[model samples]
Target: MNDSEAVMKLILHGGNARSLAMEAIAHAKRGEIAAARTALSEAAEELHHAHQLQTSLIQAEASGEKTEITMLLIHAQDHLMNAMTVKDLAVEFVDLYERMRASKGVEA
Candidate 1:
């Protein structure tokens, strides 16, 4: 795929991952641990895809095949970074929610 197409895919994957992470947090808040875990897994998958794309670009640049810097590419990177941060926090939130449920004598 072209650079623009790859960048768009990165943005799409990042957005999807972020949404899934948020969904996981919501599920955890509702005490639906299984569903929360499922959502997190899906988010991870999306992140994996995005990361692969990013790595390919990095490798190309490292091999002296420079990719032109563009606003869209920067935006895509921002989305990926934000989604990664959210996913990391979502994992913590899910763990906290499980602990809270356990402390309350509710099955986690």
Candidate 2:
């Protein structure tokens, strides 16, 4: 893909991952462990796709190809980083909710 298209793909996947992660947290808050896990799994898949797209750029650079750093690329990177942070927090939130449910003897 062209640089612009690749960058857009990254942004799309990153946003999707972030959205899924947020959905997971919401599910967890409602004690829907299965649904939460499903959402988290989807988020992980989207994140993986984004990472793979990023790795292609890294590989091109390693091969002595110069890639211009554009504002859109920078924005894509920001989205990826933010998605990662959200996913991390979502995992912790899911775990916390699970523990809270267990403590209160609420069936999942």
Candidate 3:
């Protein structure tokens, strides 16, 4: 795929991951721990795909290949970064929710 196409894919994956993380957070807030965990897992898978794309681009640049830095690429990177942060926060939220439920004598 071309650079633009790859960047778009990265952005798509990142956006999906971010959305999934948000969904996970919502589920946790509602005390649906299992659904939250599932959403988090899906988000991780999306992030993994995005990371692979980013790594391939980095490797290409490292191997004497010139990469054009475009606004779209920067946006894609931003999306990925934000998604990762959200996913991390979602994990913490899920854990907290589980603990809260346990403390309330509820089965998680």
Candidate 4:
């Protein structure tokens, strides 16, 4: 794929990961532990795909292939980083919800 296309793919996957992480938080709020965990897993998968694309670009550069640094590429990187952070926070939120439920003698 072309550089722009690759960058766009990264952005898309990163955004998907972030969205799924948010969905996880919503599920957690409703005390749906299973659903929340599932969403978090899906987000991780999406992040994995984004990371693969990023690794390929880095590898290309390491092999002496010139890569154009564009605003879109930078934006894609931002999305990936933000998504990762959000996913981490979502996991913590899910765990917190589970703990809260447990403390109340409620099963999820």
Top TM-score prediction, candidate number: 4
lDDT of 2 by residue, 1-108 (tens): 877788999999999999999999999999999999999999999999999999998898899988899999999999999999999999999999999999999977
lDDT of 1 at 90: 100
lDDT of each: 0.97, 0.96, 0.95, 0.97
Better of 3 and 4 by TM-score: 4
> What would the TM-scores of all predictions be?
0.98, 0.98, 0.98, 0.98
Q: What are the runs in model 4 whose C-alpha is more than 4 Å off?
A: none
Clashing pairs in 2: none
Residue 34 CA displacement from its true place in model 4, Å: 0.2
Give the residue spans of candidate 2 off by over 4 A.
none
Model 3 TM-score on a 0 to 1 scale: 0.98
Q: lDDT value for candidate 2?
A: 0.96
Per-residue alpha-carbon lDDT of model 4 for 1-108, expressed as tens digits?
777888999999999999999999999999999999999999999999999999999999999989999999999999999999999999999999999999999999
